[model samples]
Target: MSDAAILCRFEAARSIVRDAADLAMAMRPPPGGPSGKQKSAQDWLTEADGAVEALISERIGALFPEDGFQGEEEGRTRTGRLRWVVDPIDGTSNYARGRSRWCVSLGLMDGDQPVAGIIQAPALHETYTAVRGHGAFLNGRPIKASPVTDTRSAMVEMGWSNKVPDGIYAAKMAAILELGAMPRSGGSGALALADVACGRLDGYLEMVINLWDVAAALVLLEETGARFSPFLRDGGLDRGITLLATAPGIATDLAVALAVPLD
Candidate 1:
């Protein structure tokens, strides 16, 4: 597709994702958390997930009938060279508990390349958008990764997944502490990576994460000059896999410490 076409879709997605996030906020659970079901040990599922996905799918399908659509709640509903991958409510656990950390994420892919993306956190009133070759923005202003080179001064977040064994996850967390950096787990892979892009955090890693989780943030990271693992090359296009995205300054050392390669 031409650059114009890509940018058109990107802009449309921004509006679409923002509306979807508002829909999620309306269905958000109360402060003690909703009575959500578990997809697994700690994985959460809420009505908002499917509701938001359906809204986005319907809107996108109506706007771009030929474009493919994929969602976390509903798998691929349509197929095309230009595909849109979405995580309707990225931090279900947080959203389910009435927290403000969850978001609605949508990414555009041209074949295997992530060309553009939009991540909207309605509860926080923040929106991040990026297009390959263009810059990344947070609520309309440009943003970039942090310049902290020393691991001792960095703050990194590691996302958790049930696919990883407890012992292995602990070992990786210990390794980050060994490097003298603070470690955190925000329960939202997309936002953590966006934090890396906008310099709120120095880096983000995950033992196992799905494409929809990072699809939108990947474009943001790339536009902001952050270093990350070769997720697609490592089979992220087809299944969940390990991911490590960091500011360029801490990328090398962090990768070595975590034993996860960077792109």
Candidate 2:
């Protein structure tokens, strides 16, 4: 598809997500219906996640029915070389708890590389988008990663998967803390990456993440000159796992500190 047509498709997808996010924020949750995945001792899935995915999937299908789809809530629909990876409600846990850190992420990938991306947080009124070779933008203004040279002065974001063994999780956490940088944890990988793209945070580390979680923001980061490396070659929905993304200055240091093996 032409770049203009692709951008139009993304705008439509973004609108659907904005509506879903607004609806989710307005509705009150049922008392004691479900808690976080940690407390529940199971992966948490919510009605809002499904609702948003359905709306987004339908919109994308209407625009590009031949393109494949892989969404967080709904299953995959593989068909064409161009696939849309989506996270309808990226930070479901935070959204469920009324935190404003979540967002909707959609990425268009040709083969294994993302070519176009959009990340929108309706609650925050923030929208980030990037097309390969076109640079990244936040709310229509272009953004770049911070030029912080010293790791000690950096504000970093780190995330851990509940599925990781306790020992590994602890090791990763301890190692990150020892980096002597300010570390913060939020619920959404997409939002965290968006922050990195806009220079809100200097870096982000995650033990495990599905493609939908970082697909869109990955393009944004790249366009903004942020550095990232895949811990695994296969980052499809089925093989989601470790990833490290950071500002260009600190990418190597953070990767080495985390001991993320090189390909």
Candidate 3:
């Protein structure tokens, strides 16, 4: 499809998620309290997540039925050459707890490369989008990565799902602290990546993230001139160990400091 057509679909998809998020915010649990998916001790899901996923899937199916879909709440479906990766509600834990840091992430992938993306943080009134080769935008204005060069001057964002071992999370935090940059956590991979794209944060690191979580934001980061690499040399979709996305000139230095081996 043409870029304009993709943008139209993206906006429509974003609106669906935004409305879902709004409804989720006013939601109350039943007598038993909130329902959740115990994927494991650390990973989780909620009714809102599934609801948003259904909404996105329905919209995408209606608009682009030939495209495949891979979503956080729903699994994958095979179709044509195009695939849509979606995180209907990223940071579900935070959402379940009423934190305002969650978002909806969507990306259109042509084979393995992202061709279009959109991330909408409804509570924050922030929307990030990009079409491959068309540059990135936040609230309709173009964005670029921060020009921060020295680690000491940079403000970094990072995250680790609770699934990560406590020891490993602590060690990574310590390593980041040792780099002399201030660290912040937004609780959402997609949002943190959007921040990097808009120069709100200089860099971000995560121990592990699914393709659906990062696919859309990765395209925005690339279009905005941000850089990223896997935490290990072989850390691709297959390995899924770690990921580090950074802004402009800071990527190499941050990767070196973190000892993250690029693919």
Candidate 4:
């Protein structure tokens, strides 16, 4: 597709994520009285997730009825060739607890590849945008991953999920420590990946993550010249995928430390 076409979709996604972020912030309930249910012992789902997703689906449908849809809250709607993937709130636990680590994530994918993405963290007052060939931006300012090349100097963020076994996370974390890099978990994958785009974090790695969580950030990583391993190598696009994103300079060592396949 033409660059203009990608930008057009990017603009639409940008608007939707911003609107969803605004609505989510306004509707957030007090921590003690939060309206949410446990999708699992460790997974959470809030009213904001469904509400924001419903609004995003409706709004995107209005503008692009021919496009497909897939959301963390709503599942799949294969209406057309291009699909708009969304995660209304990436860090539901943080959002449910009134923390500022949540974000609204949206991506436009043609087939299995992301072409455009937008991530809005309202509480943080930040918006990140990216297109396939165009560069990435943070609050409209161009951005890129950090230039840190050595594992000893790279400060990386690690993402965790209950879906994966405890031993897996332990192994990866130990490897990171052994490599002599600091590892931190920020509770939001999309936001963490956005930080990588803007050079705030040197790297991010997760064993298993859904498409919604990383869909938008993948585009940002690509446009900013950050490197990441292919997600869900063993499953279809609808299933969970392992994710690893790093500044180009630190990618090799980090990947090696984590035992991620470089091919």
Candidate 5:
């Protein structure tokens, strides 16, 4: 598609995602948190997820009838050359608990390539946007990955999912620690990856993460000069797989330590 076409979708996505964030914030639970249910161990599902996704799906569908949509709540709808993949409420656990870490994520894809994306974290008052070859941004300012090259000084977030075995999780955690880098887990994969993009964190790795969780962040990482795994090349288009995104300085070493491939 032409730059104009992608930019059109990118602009529309920013507005749609912002409105979705507003809707989510209004429905956010109080300090005590909401009575959310679990889809699985540590995997939360809340009313806002569906509501926000419905709004995004409807708006995107209306604005671009020919584009496809794949959302966390409703799954895939119409098919088109450019697909909109959304995680209406990424970090639902945090959102459920009224924490300031959740976000509404939307990504534009051309086949397997993430062409553009918008990730809005209303609670944190931060928004990240990126289009392929156009660079990434935090709020309205341009952003880039950290220049830290030392493992000992780098901080990496290791995302946890119930889908992976306990042993596997432990092994990866140990690997990160062995690298002498500080390791952490922040519950939200998208935000963690976003953190890597804007230099808040050096790297993010997850044994199993879905397309919606990382789709939007892919372009952010790319435009910010962060190195990441070849997720789609490794079958991420059809199913969940390990994901490792890191700064260029630390990417090679981090990938080896975690046994994850770099793109």
Candidate 6:
């Protein structure tokens, strides 16, 4: 597709993401309270999750019937060349628990790499978007990753995968701490990457995260001048992959600390 077509898709995605975020915010439960069941030992699934995903899929499909879609709740619908990756609520556990750190993530891919994306955290009143080389934005203003060079002063968010072994999570955390940087986990990979995009967090690390979870944020991070390890493009979609998105200064050090294999 031409650049103009991709930009149009990018604009369309921004509106779709906004609508999805609004739906999620409306369905969000009261603070400090939750009404949802466990999808797994720790993973959560709420009525809002499916409701939001369905709305996004329906709306986007209506606008671009020829485009494919993949959502966290409904899985994949392959119809054509372009694929819309949607995470109705990136932080389900936090959303179910009434925390304000989750977001609605939407991304478009042409073949392998992302062509456009958006991550909107309505609860936090923050919206991030990017079109391949068009730069990234937060709340309509341009954003950039942190320029900090020292690991000692870096603040990185370390995400844990429920599917991974307990030992791996522990080891990764320990590795980050040993590097003399503070490590934290906000329970949402999309939001974490958004934070990295806007320089709120210096870096983000995750052992195994889904494509829907980070697809939008991935583009945002890239456009914001943040560095990241190989994700689904290298055939890690169904199998998942270790992820590292960070300021340029910490990329190599972080990979080394986590023993993340470089591609």
Of 4 and 6, the candidate ranking higher by TM-score: 6
Residue 77's lDDT within candidate 3 is 62
The lDDT of each candidate is: 0.92, 0.77, 0.77, 0.85, 0.92, 0.84
Candidate 5 vs candidate 6: the lDDT winner is 5
- What are the per-residue Cα lDDT tens digits for candidate 1 across 21-140? 888989998889455888897789998899999999999999999999989888999999899999988988888789899899999999989999889999899999999999999999
Off by over 4 Å in 1: none
RMSD of each: 0.8, 2.6, 3.0, 1.6, 0.9, 1.3
Please identify which of the two predictions, 4 or 5, would achieve the higher lDDT against the true structure: 5
Candidates by lDDT, descending order: 5, 1, 4, 6, 3, 2
Candidate 3 lDDT over residue span 95-114, tens digit each: 76666777888888877777
Clashing pairs in 6: none
> How much is 143 displaced in model 2, in angstroms?
1.0
- lDDT digits (tens) for residues 91-126 of candidate 2: 777676666777878888877778888888877888
lDDT of 5 by residue, 1-263 (tens): 88999999899888889899999999998877454888888888999999999999999999999999999888898799999999999999888888888999999999878999899999999999999999999988999999999999999999888899999999999999999999998888999999999999999999999999999999999999999999989998889999999999999899999989897
Pairs of residues at least 3 apart in sequence or in different chains that clash in candidate 1: none
Arrange candidates by TM-score, descending: 1, 5, 6, 4, 2, 3
Candidate 3 at 124: error in angstroms?
0.8
TM-score of 6: 0.96
Model 3 weakest lDDT span, ten residues long: 230-239
